[model samples]
Target: MLVLIGGAAGTIAFDLFGRAISPILGFASLNPIGLARGFLGTLGLPNSGAYGHLMHLLFVGLLAYPIGWLFVARPVFSRVLVGLHWAFASAAYGVGLWVFAIGGIAWFAGNPAFLGFAPIAWVALVAHVLYSVVTAATINYIERLQHAR
Candidate 1:
């Protein structure tokens, strides 16, 4: 149960940080509502933006929790999981930064609407790293607890 909760928390933290950063980086329109609406439309659920958000959140929770539990149950696999986690996290951060830089450059190069929010982007990047680190630590701790039992 604790592992499940931790995974859910991690997923929420990750998505929250991503949402915050995307707007500030200018990669996404600042309107979350419109974004949600469009996302829902893509899934054939045209008037269910709220439901779409909920489903996305649920998907994250489901993916993370089982992965977390698996890591906890198999200590030998924990190291591999941690390595993959870092690789995945770094790739995500790198992509986000690249997108932000491109947008900033485009905006400065005469696309007046492409302005980037560097500060917010930086904050979001930091948040994502923090989240990954914390999740890794929590998984390690959980592994230890399981082993001790």
Candidate 2:
């Protein structure tokens, strides 16, 4: 549960940061946020709108908190949850990579000069990977706390 909550929180936090920085950095309005909406919609989930995006973030956070509590509340589930966390994290990373590649290619094709965005992409990718790692570590630590309790 900690894993889920952490995952959701991580997702929301990243989205918020991405939305805030995208325009400042001259990224397309549809870059990260649009990618998220499209991916969620593809999975038949609700897409985040300007207003609803905040709600969705809260929703994910709420769902994750309880799951975290559950895992923390039960010792036996800790290991299983941790394993699941890594599995999901891996999958999410893969999806993120796919989205980045597709979006980057499309953007570059339309604006050949957009290769200037390469440094931005590189920086963003590094930050993203770091975020994922931290989220995974947080989940793991939370699980350990649950087990220790």
Candidate 3:
């Protein structure tokens, strides 16, 4: 439950920052919807902007990422580096996510790998780290609240 809440909050923050703040700050805008459409193309599927939006928002943002944080990242990191602060751990996880999604997955999605190491890539790195930190912070806060009861 906490993980879901955290993940949702984190996704919202990521979307908001990428869509609203980054462009206003003169950073390249993230086009997650277009990315999703490209991913579908890689799979030889017809592009549907609506489906792309749904997949990005519902599947990736709302479900897969949070579950990944809870089941994969937290468990492995906890045992490997005991007593590590959640913020640091989450930031590391965000870097990993950036590598997997931007560095690796970009190739399959027909984009230059690592966005050719461009400024947008840096912005993406920042966005990913922001997402992860927010997610972890939200989860930790909720857990503390529950324990305080």
| Candidate achieving the largest TM-score | 3
Between candidates 1 and 3, the lDDT winner? 3
Regions more than 4 Å wrong, model 3: none
Worst 10 residues of 3 by lDDT: 54-63
Q: Taking the tens digit of each residue's C-alpha lDDT, what string does model 3 give over 33-146?
A: 887788888998776998888878877777787788878998889999999988899999999888987887777898999889988888888888888889888988998999
State the lDDT of candidate 2 residue by residue for 68-137, as single tens digits. Answer: 3334423433455665555355435534643453445335334333235565455445445544544555
Please report, in order, the local distance difference test score of every candidate based on alpha carbons: 0.48, 0.48, 0.86
Candidate 3's C-alpha lDDT? 0.86
- Which stretches of model 1 miss by more than 4 angstroms? 1-3, 12-37, 46-49, 61-120
lDDT at residue 126 of model 3 (Cα atoms): 86
Check candidate 2 and list the clashing pairs. 1-67, 1-68, 2-68, 5-64
Worst 10 residues of 1 by lDDT: 105-114
The C-alpha TM-scores of every prediction are: 0.45, 0.43, 0.94
* Per-residue lDDT of candidate 1, residues 2-41 (tens digit): 5565556665565666666555666532332343344456
Error of 3 at 71 (Å): 1.1
RMSD of 2: 8.4
Model 2 off-target regions past 4 Å?
Answer: 16-30, 37-117
